[model samples]
Target: MQLLEYISFLLLSSVKFFFFYPVFITKEDYNFLEAMTFGLTAGFIGSSTFIFFGDVMYQFFHRLALKKAITHPPKEKKQRSIKHRRLIVKLRDDYGLWGIAFLAPILITIPLACILATRFYHNKGKILGHFMIAIAFWSALIYIFKSSLIHLIS
Candidate 1:
């Protein structure tokens, strides 16, 4: 049961909600080091999954969508989509990968950040490194301030 919980913690941490899990682990009588290690490991696994497989998965899904497409797209929807795309491009240009890295663990999920980094930066090592750095930073911050976060949550 304990082993399963640890695994669950790792899996949950991989996607998001990692920040809140450390307190749970500590309450389970695990040490801070254990929680930090699991968080770091999960962050790496999550980021790596998207960094390597993101494009392939996206292409596969794209093909699937194309197969079931509507013959004629709505003109108003197309115009709205064009505006959204321009906004996204502008934000991407302004913030770049570092912004994603900084916000990944806290605001953005690891997979999304990794996908964005892989899409725009095209540097696997750099993407992974930045993500790990962000994870490490957040892990340390959260662990140090767990009491405060828990209080705030309550």
Candidate 2:
């Protein structure tokens, strides 16, 4: 029964809501090491899968974008374009990949974060390392809040 619960926890962690689900799984009592292992492993797997194959996904999206562009020509830009671009640049400059990595596992979900990181940042190794750190960090944090999370659930 416990093994089945562990497997279920792993699958649930991989899909989304990586943090809270483990607490949900072990609602009555928390097993710190077990939750950490399963959650971290699932996060790593998701991050690896997306980051490694990002190129293919990128190309696919790029081609689709090109097709859309060719089919429908773009309209004239609004005067606010420059300000918007500046804001984006400023945010990117200030936060960049690390911010995305730190928030990814807990907030944005792993696959989207990995894709965004790979799209903007050129370093696969660094991205993966950041993801590993983020997963570990969030996993530990979630486990630390096991009692509260379980209480909220039940």
Candidate 3:
């Protein structure tokens, strides 16, 4: 029952973000190796699913939109808010796809980052590699700091 709980927690966490796994596993009394493995697995599975399947969803929606356009015709493009436009432009111009990939696992949800990466880059391998590096780095950092902190407090 405890193992099942831990597995379910990690699976859900991977779909959410990589940042919380170290803290979560430590709290659950898992060792460093178990924490690292579970954290990485969660991140990899979530991101990989989005990277491959997300594009298929995107195309399906895009084609749907195209078909709708043919039947209904198009309207004037809606004016996007300046803030929204600026943020998109900034991400594209300054950060680009790599920046999103590097920050996605930590800052945003794994699936979101994967979707953004899929949208920008056609090379799934490159995005996956970068995500793996980011996940490893974050998982180690979280585990080390969180474990040390726990010891200090206890």
Q: Pick the candidate with the highest TM-score.
A: 1
For candidate 3, lDDT tens digit of each residue in 19-87?
Answer: 457557867777889878877888888878888898887788899999999999867766676677677
Winner on TM-score between 1 and 3 is 1
Error of 2 at 49 (Å): 0.8
Cα-based TM-score, every candidate = 0.79, 0.73, 0.78
User: If ranked by TM-score, best first, what sequence of candidates would result?
Assistant: 1, 3, 2
State the weakest 10-residue window (summed lDDT) of model 3: 14-23
Local error of candidate 2 at 121, Å? 2.4
Each model's C-alpha lDDT?
A: 0.76, 0.76, 0.78
TM-score of model number 3: 0.78
Candidate 3's displacement at residue 60, Å, is 4.4
The clash count for each model shown is 0, 0, 0
- lDDT string for model 1 (1-154, tens) is 9889777877788888465556565576445687678678888878888889989987888787776566544345567778967865776788777777878888778877787777788889988888888888887777768756666888
Candidates 2 and 3 compared: the better one by TM-score is 3
Model 3 misplaced stretches (Cα beyond 4 Å)? 18-20, 60-82
In candidate 1, the residue pairs with backbone N, CA or C atoms under 3 Å apart (3 or more residues apart, or in different chains) clash, namely none
TM-score-superior candidate, 1 or 2: 1
Model 2 poorest 10 in a row by lDDT? 21-30
RMSD (CA, Å), each prediction:
3.2, 4.0, 3.2
